[model samples]
Target: MGYLYIFGTILFTVYGQLILKWRIEKYGSLPPLVKDKILFLLQLLVDPLILSGFLSAFVASIFWMGAMTKFDISYAYPFMSLSFVLVFILSVFLFQEPVTLYKVIGLSFIVVGIMITSQSV
Candidate 1:
């Protein structure tokens, strides 16, 4: 059940990251002018998808809180790295982002680290 909380955290974290990227891509590049930049960000803030992304962050935090109750932070925090591994894989496919060999290796290390740390508890 505690692992479920950690899973929930990973899923929500991935959703927030992907959603924000998708919505921002729709808006195109940031404006050069300072005033326009502020307005551009304000517009994104009001966007429903963007709002949901932000909300997902809040939800992830709640899940983290739940996870903390069930295990030592050292035992559980490593699981959060799954979010990065997932988001990295997901973005490459979902967003048509490039995948490099170095990135794959780096993420592989993170997964290995999680496996090692998961055994420490």
Candidate 2:
């Protein structure tokens, strides 16, 4: 069950990050609000991508809390680093981002780290 929770956390984290990227692309960055900031905020909130991302993030937060309750932080936190690899893959497929050798090497290291940490757990 702990492993399941960990996997769920990883999924939630990855999906949450992807959604955030979608939101950013759809809505762009939040500009400095000098005046009529409330209207700007409202406009930002009305964006579908932003709303979906926010919802996914909220769900991820809840799953993360559940995972934390089920496992030691030391064990669980390292697993979250899986997001680095996940984001890389997602970026390549979803956004047509380049996957270079350096990125592959970095992702390999991330996998190695996760393996080592899993051994400890």
Q: Using lDDT as the measure, which candidate wins?
A: 1
* lDDT against true structure, model 1: 0.94
> How far does residue 93 in candidate 2 sit from its true spot (Å)?
0.6
Q: Using Cα atoms with residue i matched to residue i, what is each candidate's TM-score against the true structure?
A: 0.97, 0.79
Q: What are the Cα lDDT values of the candidates?
A: 0.94, 0.79
- Measured by TM-score, the strongest candidate is 1
Native-to-model Cα distance after best TM-score fit, residue 35 in candidate 2, in Å: 5.5
lDDT of 2 at 54: 76
> Could you tell me how far off, in angstroms, the CA of residue 108 lies in candidate 1 after the best superposition?
0.8
TM match of model 2 to true structure: 0.79
Q: Taking the tens digit of each residue's C-alpha lDDT, what string does model 2 give over 20-105?
A: 67766775656687566666678877877767767767776777788888888887888888888988999899989998999999
Cα RMSD (Å) between model 1 and the true structure?
0.9
User: How many Å off is the CA of 48 in candidate 2?
Assistant: 3.0
TM-score of 1: 0.97
